[model samples]
Target: MTSLKLVIIFATLVAVSLAGVVRRDATDDDDDSGEEKHHGPAFLEGLDAATKDKFKAIFRDHSLKGDAKDAALLKLATSVLTPEKLAEFKTHQVEFKKKREQWKADYDAKYAKLSPNAKKAADEIKGLWEKDGMDRAAKKAKKEEILKSLTEAERKEVQDLFPHRGKKPSRN
Candidate 1:
């Protein structure tokens, strides 16, 4: 599971970095011509000025340019992400799914034993989660209340089962 999570996280980072590259290249289009410009790899756009300069030096070292540079970067990425590594990730993913299912089953059993009012609140939250018109802040507050009602073990299990879902992205 950890391996799968890491792959997902890495893929997300790569996509975001590539998006920065695309956005930067899009904005720097030549006014007089329709030809697409080869700005280094999309990953470079996400770096700070100093980091960019450092990478520029490295690019010069290899004498990679335009399409060749893109191919080089792609080759580098593929080489690092080997089939064996991906197979390990798949194994971890299967283990994680099994564990998450067990946790969810436990959560259901624990939820059934909650006090009536807590159960009511949980049901309401579940209903709201299924539908979509509620105010975001109100839904968040209700969700927090529902979590607070859980036993410590249940809460921990829930957190472990979905660690990334509720988190906000960190500022770089």
Candidate 2:
């Protein structure tokens, strides 16, 4: 075999060996500490343990992130489920997506009505919340500063984007 082919074959063998050695019992709780982790909805309880463990692997796949991960996971999970379970699970997924879309639309409408300064403040807070580097305390302090500067009406409009989740958190 060619030298390059030998290297590729050697690398593949090493990877396969390492994977076998590193593999853990998927039934053992999703975490290293052996605590059961729930990756799917409660309805998933109807699924067999092996199937449920398959879902857990999708959630833990580090290669996917953000919306792409969500979409890919949904597709994979749907493909993996049995016909009987797939129908209900797909329906649930559709309902969830509808709710998320509605929420985003509602928030967008409210944001469009804000004053220029209010828009800027809201955007800044969103940026800080998503971006890395800044400590959470520092980010919150900066956000609270902008939030406090808002007119009461703007505050009401921009307060907790996910208000349905709970009371507006005390910004203090």
Candidate 3:
């Protein structure tokens, strides 16, 4: 009789544990479903025509603003987003931030090894980056001048020395 009672108690405990695991799994599924709903294209389809037009304009030119831009974004969000999709987007944003930080660290480490003259030139470039509200035309001209001064061999050597500096892989 005691053995029978013990068996029954063990069986009950096992069933209860299994039930908790199933509940947790269900909760996880619900969260994933919510995220999927937000990321899915169905929400985008919900925006009004006017909102869609505004969104298109913004995409073509970033300078567009005022109520039109606001309306378009609002429409896009309303049409496209569920709470779940927003959460998923937020997750991606967090990952991007982490990557940006890592890249900055690598850049700083690479910059630390530059020769004194090279460092001075890099500092001048850095100052340009630091200058707030600088005119874009002047900045472009300065950048062009810097590039124009470098001989092909010097550019190639620099690119070789700093693998991250060039857009393309060095042939040599």
Model 2 Cα lDDT, one tens digit per residue, 1-172 = 6999999999999999877767645454456754455546754756667877776676676556557766876786667777767777777777777987898898888788878877888898888877678887999898889889998877766675547844556435
Instruction: Please identify model 3 stretches exceeding 4 Å from their true place.
Output: 1-81, 148-172
lDDT (Cα, tens digit) per residue for candidate 3, span 47-117 = 45564455456545544444455455555555555777555544644664687678677767867776655
> Estimated TM-score per prediction?
0.36, 0.55, 0.43
Model 2, residue 65: displacement in angstroms? 6.7
Order of quality (TM-score)? 2, 3, 1
Local distance difference test values of all predictions, in order: 0.61, 0.74, 0.58
- The parts of candidate 1 lying over 4 Å away from their true place are 1-81, 144-172
Candidate 1 to truth, TM: 0.36
Which candidate, 1 or 3, would have the higher TM-score against the true structure? 3
At residue 148, candidate 3 shows an lDDT of 57
- TM-score-wise, the better of 2 and 3 is 2
Cα error of candidate 3 at position 46, Å:
8.7
Could you give candidate 1's per-residue lDDT for residues 50-162 as a string of tens digits?
64455456466434544576455445444443565435434544665687678678768867676665566666666766556777688888778777888875555445434
Clashing pairs in 3: 34-84, 38-85, 39-85, 43-79, 43-80, 44-79, 44-80
Which candidate achieves the best TM-score against the true structure?
2
Q: Could you say which candidate leads in lDDT?
A: 2
Locate the minimum summed-lDDT window of 10 residues in model 1: 38-47
In terms of lDDT, the poorest run of 10 residues in model 2 is: 34-43
